[model samples]
Target: MAKKTTQATPKAAENEQQSATAQKPHILPDRVWLVLARRAYEEPLRQVGTVEADDIELARVYARSIYDEFAWVEMALVPRETLVTVIEA
Candidate 1:
């Protein structure tokens, strides 16, 4: 006696293919942003920290939320890729 094998129907195979396609990894829009802030007008902007966000507005909000403990007079966020490196250590 031979063992019986069950085969998937056409619809089931299509659904399986769709599910496999859907299960593929999706790339997120996040980018590394450098946060700059200054305590006072006299002080220069300093690289306080970094944040990951999809866009500049979100990065700004995230940076402020994370680093707002200080009484900073000015704050700015720029994508890390935009920074021109003069020297590397």
Candidate 2:
């Protein structure tokens, strides 16, 4: 009689996958800022005015630093490759 080989059960495979996933660092998604801004906005819009702040460039700098800080965990990432479309009727 020939001996049969057994593969790892699904549960074992799943556990191995989970452990591997836990070892990686977190990835900051592109929408991360939008989400952060939304949460920030939750606190009443302070200094509401027509004046614009030149913070976009500053934010880009911060984002670059943040990206290097967390470059592992995988998640839905959005790249700023196109202009945001505003649909107004």
Candidate 3:
């Protein structure tokens, strides 16, 4: 009789997952967020914004809030002014 090897073992699967996670891009603590273009839509699917997030969870929270707050196109959390940078040496 011959023994067969499985396609994936528990340890192998875990290691694969770990490696996949490590391969993902590292998010920073803060990011430049576009303030506009997220409040014009009426449906949840329509509202979309871009921002730098520390993690995927934070990005999700921000997207949800933007959708809910702009349900009626009244309340907006995004800023009006363009991005500003000050350099000090």
Per-model TM against the reference: 0.65, 0.27, 0.26
Q: Assess each prediction's global lDDT (C-alpha) against the native.
A: 0.89, 0.42, 0.54
Compared with the true structure, what per-residue lDDT tens digits does model 1 show for residues 1-89? Answer: 89999999999999999999898847675799989999999999999999999877888789989998899999888888987889986
What RMSD, rounded to one decimal, does every model reach? 7.1, 15.5, 13.0
Question: Model 2: per-residue lDDT, tens digit, 1-89?
Answer: 89999999999999999999887746543232320211242353221112111355544555444444333232122333332878945
Model 1 scores a TM of 0.65
| Model 2 C-alpha lDDT versus the unseen true structure | 0.42
Error (Å) of candidate 1 at residue 15 is 29
Rank the candidate models, highest TM-score first: 1, 2, 3
RMSD from true fold, candidate 1: 7.1
Report the candidate with higher lDDT, 1 versus 2. 1
Off by over 4 Å in 1: 1-29
Worst 10 residues of 1 by lDDT: 21-30
Residue 64's C-alpha lDDT in candidate 2? 48
Off by over 4 Å in 3: 1-3, 28-89
